[model samples]
Target: MTNSAKPRARAADKRRRLATEAARVLHEQGVERTTLADIARAADVPVGNVYYYFKTKDELVLAALSEHSAHLDELTGRLDQLPDPHDRLKALIEAWISQRETAARYGCPTGTLAVELDKRADGILDTEAGTAIRRLLQWAEEQFRALGLPDPDDLALTLVSGYQGMSLLTNALRDPDIMTRQGAHLLRWLDSLKDTDPAA
Candidate 1:
């Protein structure tokens, strides 16, 4: 590669790494507590270099949000591979349950971030952070609609809310096992909805 191309590529790599570390720090510490220096330290990039990619902390936060959105899109793509909508929904629940230990320690990253950002009076991070949850709800709603549910919207809301509620409880109780138990209950609930519609 040419010298100019090499530096540009390295800069891109550094920015990507910074965004990833910023997302992790934001999830663990919340936006108010996370600083660009923290992300720089986490990414092992010089603190000054961060300015080359992001002019302010908020920009870094947005970058992290973008990274998170891409992650959700990737997850949705993977879930779409399952032909059965029910199985797809179950896979989503199982995926969340599998992260029980992390949720118990740090809460649900997307949920917690959304709540935290929403609580901000300035509304700066509101739209971007909110998109994370909104995207999940939309994906769940699509699955429910595909299942031929009469009220797919409501079912989608319930599924997302239920998962968020369980995550909140798991974090509050400091018990990862709570997620496992709740996951089983959710699965049973999903099964109960099966065959509710003859046309489905």
Candidate 2:
């Protein structure tokens, strides 16, 4: 029993390591450029081992995309700390921009992969990524509604679009200034809303 369990444990560990390395490679080089061999080298595993866990590159890419959802959870936790709903929105926006500043080369993996999958009409990963994004937007909308904001659903969707658009621009421009300016602008816009609303 102990010997049998050892192999299973090792296989689980190998899968975990491969998944982590795949995510890092996908984030750095994207799904198109990152190859299975590249992932194997980064993962410090044999190429055959990578294949043992994933039959094709698509599988690895999808797994990495799923792992990336954890990033959204982290953002949600950070946004939840703010007491005011307006501040929560601002904090969420600013924190995301700040994160993009650090993760510039990788861009937003969720958005990037979703866009790529859409072009190919790869329905499975595309649907998974879209679901994660929609969940985030829904959460933001609920926060806005809690603050009694008008058209919270529309505003939340708009904000999500703006955030992704800025991330793409920041990557193309390679300028932190754009992120800084855009983040401040978002905060200012929220401030204006707060000024008008008594509940805020």
Candidate 3:
């Protein structure tokens, strides 16, 4: 390839790596607590180099939020591959529960980020940070729709809210079992919904 193309490719790779590392740092530490230095250290770059990629911490966080969105898409895309709608829904719960330990340690990645960003004084970051949660809820709604559930909208809220509530408790209580237990109940609730669905 041309020298100019090589430099551009390397720059893009470095930016992506920084954003990914920033997302992880933000997840492990809250947005308020994470610093550009923390992200740079995690990405193994000089702290000054962070400004070359992101002029402000807010810009870096926006990149991190974008990175988080990509990750959620990758995860939910896999869940959508399951043939059965109910199975797909169940798989979503299983995936969250699989991260119970991490959630217990650092709170749900999306949930915590949503909560923190919602507190911004200007409010735009709130909407940006909510993207991951919205993606999850919308995807769940689609799965319920495929199940022929009449209340896909309400059911989607119920499903996501339950997980969010359980995430809070799991973190507050510092018990991963809270998520596991709630996930079981959620799974059974999904099964019972099959009974209510005439299509089932």
Those runs of model 3 whose alpha carbons end farther than 4 Å from true positions after fitting are none
- Residue-level lDDT of model 3, residues 1-200, one tens digit each, is 89899989988888988999988999999999988999999998889888889999999989988998999899888987888989999999999899899989888877898899888898887798888889888999999999999979899999999999999999999999999999999999999999998986
Q: Score candidate 2 by TM-score against the native.
A: 0.88
The lDDT of each candidate is 0.90, 0.79, 0.91
TM-score each candidate: 0.96, 0.88, 0.97
Error of 3 at 182 (Å): 0.4
Output the number of the lDDT-best candidate. 3
- Alpha-carbon RMSD of each model: 1.2, 2.2, 1.0
Candidate with maximal TM-score:
3
Pitting candidate 1 against candidate 3, the one with the higher lDDT is 3
* Residue pair clashes in candidate 3: none
Estimate candidate 3's alpha-carbon lDDT, on a 0 to 1 scale: 0.91
User: What is the number of backbone collisions in each predicted candidate, taken in the order shown?
Assistant: 0, 0, 0
Q: Which stretch of 10 consecutive residues in model 2 shows the poorest summed lDDT?
A: 100-109
Error of 2 at 151 (Å): 0.7
Off by over 4 Å in 1: none
